[model samples]
Target: MSKDINYLIKSSIEIYFKNSQIRDISFNTFLPENRNLKSKRSKLKMEKEGKNNLRFFIESKDITAFRASINEIITFGKIFENVLNLVE
Candidate 1:
């Protein structure tokens, strides 16, 4: 069974991280090809909410990894937000 169904250490979180420039920067900065990421095996689900709005669903079966991944994403988002504020 999948982690979502097994309750065997699963979690998810959503983030905007949508601006085109920010998205490009994040992609380059985060290195999606990295195999060492805690959420490497996790599934990434994304939805386009609007022109520049996106909803990200990060899911993972490894509880520790899941939390760590969320933390990492939050840090990325915080940095993005700070940069966005400066630009705007």
Candidate 2:
């Protein structure tokens, strides 16, 4: 893909993070490890975009795994948001 497409994707994901409040201060401090993993049927990568931004790139061999990964991420985000609310 071109740079513009890449930028667009990153921007969109960042917006989701912003709106979901997933990039809160506490979460940034304990960000996931920045690495890429490949399995027989999928790939997963987590990277820090900048000082306070994280990017997750997940690829699966099939749509089912892809959807599952997405759901898990969304669920994790919701749980984290709730925890932050509780702490504050």
Candidate 3:
């Protein structure tokens, strides 16, 4: 990844929740150098190919509840991204 892009993503993650009370969102960038990226959300797999990808993992057992959660998350995420872009 380009340094600038990586800086932007790390900056976004750091800046987004710095003053918020949210705790469900977290990340890690440390590995032994051989482990592939792995995370579980909604029983699906999210692949990481570059620094520009924004991905999250959510899990739910109930189909209806899961759909509702997905909708809420996506809505909020879009709004948040828009706000971030505006700030830029």
Candidate 4:
């Protein structure tokens, strides 16, 4: 990924974890064993791709769950951008 995109993803994840708390959702910087089995609806995993990039992995049992998980991440990113714009 380009530097800007990587920075955005990194920032979004950091901001989300720092500011929000939701039931059944968790963030792990490192991969976890047997984590998927704990969530029947969905699971989100974030891994470092390199020094500055991140890779997000989402697993869901059905389409609805998958869509909701994706939408939630998108919403977080949008909120982060809005806050950044305000600060700037």
lDDT by residue for model 3 over 4-87, one digit each (tens)? 322111111112344222222222221211134222223322233233343444454445445644564456566666755777
Q: Candidate 1 lDDT (Cα, whole model)? A: 0.57
Q: Candidate order by TM-score, highest to lowest?
A: 2, 4, 1, 3
Instruction: Show model 1 residue runs off by greater than 4 Å.
Output: 1-41
Considering lDDT, which of the candidate structures 1 and 3 is the better prediction for this target? 1
Q: Write the per-residue lDDT of candidate 2 for residues 1-88, one digit (tens) a residue.
A: 3323221111113313543245555345334422223354445555556556666677665655566556655665677678868987
Clashes of each: 0, 0, 1, 0
Better of 1 and 4 by lDDT: 1
> Which window of ten consecutive residues has the lowest lDDT sum in model 1?
30-39
Clash pairs, model 1 backbone: none
So what's the TM-score on candidate 3? 0.35
lDDT of 2: 0.51
Q: Could you tell me every candidate's TM-score relative to the true structure?
A: 0.51, 0.56, 0.35, 0.51
Q: After superposition on all CA atoms, how large is the RMSD of candidate 1?
A: 5.1
How should the candidates be ordered by lDDT, best one leading? 1, 2, 4, 3
RMSD per model, one decimal: 5.1, 8.2, 15.7, 13.0
Error of 4 at 74 (Å): 0.3
**lDDT for model 3, on a 0 to 1 scale?**
0.37
